[model samples]
Target chain A: MEVINIQGTDDTPNVILDKNNNKFEISGRSLPEDVNMFYEPIMDWIDGYAEAPNEKTEFNFKLEYFNTASSKIILDILLKFEEIVESGHDVKIKWHYHEEEEDMLEAGEEYADIVEIPFEYEAYTD
Target chain B: MENSHENHSFLDFAYQLYRTMKTNEISLVYEGEVTQDITKTFTSLTEKSLAKSEESNAVQRKVFNVMVECLQNISKHADALSEEEDERRGIVMVSKGDDCYNIITGNVIKNGKIPGLKENLEQVNSLDKKGLSDLYKKQMKEGRISDKGGAGLGLIDIAKKTGSELSYQFKKISDEVSFFILTSTIRRNN
Candidate 1:
């Protein structure tokens, strides 16, 4: 499958989905004006990746900030990984937040509770 | 002499506006069309101002997030007062109190939207934190994004982050339009 790499901007996050190198991560801020237009293709790629996926998939979400619209899209992306898990594959989400950002941690916990997948949190310092 | 007199009066008006802002603890104010580029500029400017004040990281993020949502709400939902004007013009102001920061925005909206918006705001204001969280999750799981690119979750999300009730008012502007003002407060100690 082709790798999906998108550079981050002031209003969008950087995304990299590569099954070849076993790298899948999304990080940075996300507050795009047209969220559906920005996230549709990324969701499609994930759907394709789920078809012939890796034995173990670890997706990282290291978001600095995201608006409510992007938050919904993030959940959809996580749910896709949940599907991968239900298909007899191992999937773990590494949720990264800055040490000072308690709300981000809580956000990850909330998503973990909603989705059936396992989540490991990683806190970092700037 | 006429040009000098005009310049003197302009400076006086400017100084008066500056004094009002200072007295109100307002750090930023913008009144015009709110596009994506304008939203970006406002957020960045607020970010810089918050940094200079030595606010906590969490508070800075909350203020920034609320400001973005408020600005985008205007961009998506604001209606021009007249048919000839097609811009989403609105006013946004950021003020700091001793204990909290207030994000205030106002825009013209159709009078027909008043009832539904009122009910929504009342419903959101009535919820506690847990209820708001549940509503947010439910909406995220089920709510469809509108043609205007809203997921109907902005208010709920703002309530969740700030842990404060959403305060709002609608002033009738004409037979067909009203000015809607919304203020979200974030406590610094939180």
Candidate 2:
């Protein structure tokens, strides 16, 4: 498995998924110019990784903000992880939001209910 | 107040607003090729405008996000092939009002979308703060199975950001297309 990095933009977020260090994270603002174009590579990479898979896959999502289009893509990514877990891989998602942002905390809970994988919510102060 | 003469050109509309801003000496206008491009343009415009006067950065970001969401909503759902639409191909205007920022977005909505728009917006406007928050969570859990395009979260975000209710109107152009206008307001902090 190989790691991929996409830098954040004024309208989009930064994505860093490193297979070597076993660290996968998505952070920053996420209102992309073309959401499909921006997320396709990330989706493809995850699909490829789930084939060989690791002992446990931990996804760290720390988004300061994201748009509606992005919410769907995040759901799509989590659903793919559910498939990986169904195949008996250990997978957990750590959903982080700013301590003051209650909306984001609830958003994490919503995704947790939709996907099969366990999602742990954490609030952090910047 | 709406113009009863019904001028459909975006340039005409922009010029009108531009004249109003020049008199006040405290606003900016932005144009771009796409919805996201235009959003970035307006984001910078707002940031620079506010920073010039040394306004609150946090409040400016919230207002900017609300403005961007309103614009994107028009770009994603606006009806196509209209001659009146601007060169960027959609009409989203953000102007500085006396004590607030006003966003006016014009788009074309297909006939089928009007019913859903009315229903969802009605539900949104009817909800209290707690109710809207709960509805946002509920919709998120159910996913985007019913949306015409995306998760239909923009309106909710707009509502939350400004703490203002959405105001909309639909002008029937033909059997298939109706001109949709959405207006949202953000109060400026002194």
DockQ for all models, in order?
Answer: 0.80, 0.32
Candidate 2: give the clashing pairs.
none
Docking class of 1: high
* Per-residue C-alpha lDDT of model 2 across residues B42-66, encoded as one tens digit per residue: 7767767776864454456566677
Which candidate ranks first by DockQ, i.e. highest? Answer: 1
lDDT of 2 by residue, A1-126 (tens): 777988988877889988878889999888864677788899999999888788898999999778777887898899899999999999999999877666578778778867899998898986
Q: What is the number of residue pairs that collide in model 1?
A: 0
* lDDT (C-alpha, whole model) for all candidates: 0.93, 0.76
TM-score of 1: 0.96
Candidate 1 residue lDDT tens string, B1-190 = 9999999999999999999999989998999999999999999999998889889999999999999999999999999989899999999999999999999999999999999999989999999988898888899889877878888998988898999999999999999999999999999997
Over 4 Å off, model 1:
B1-9
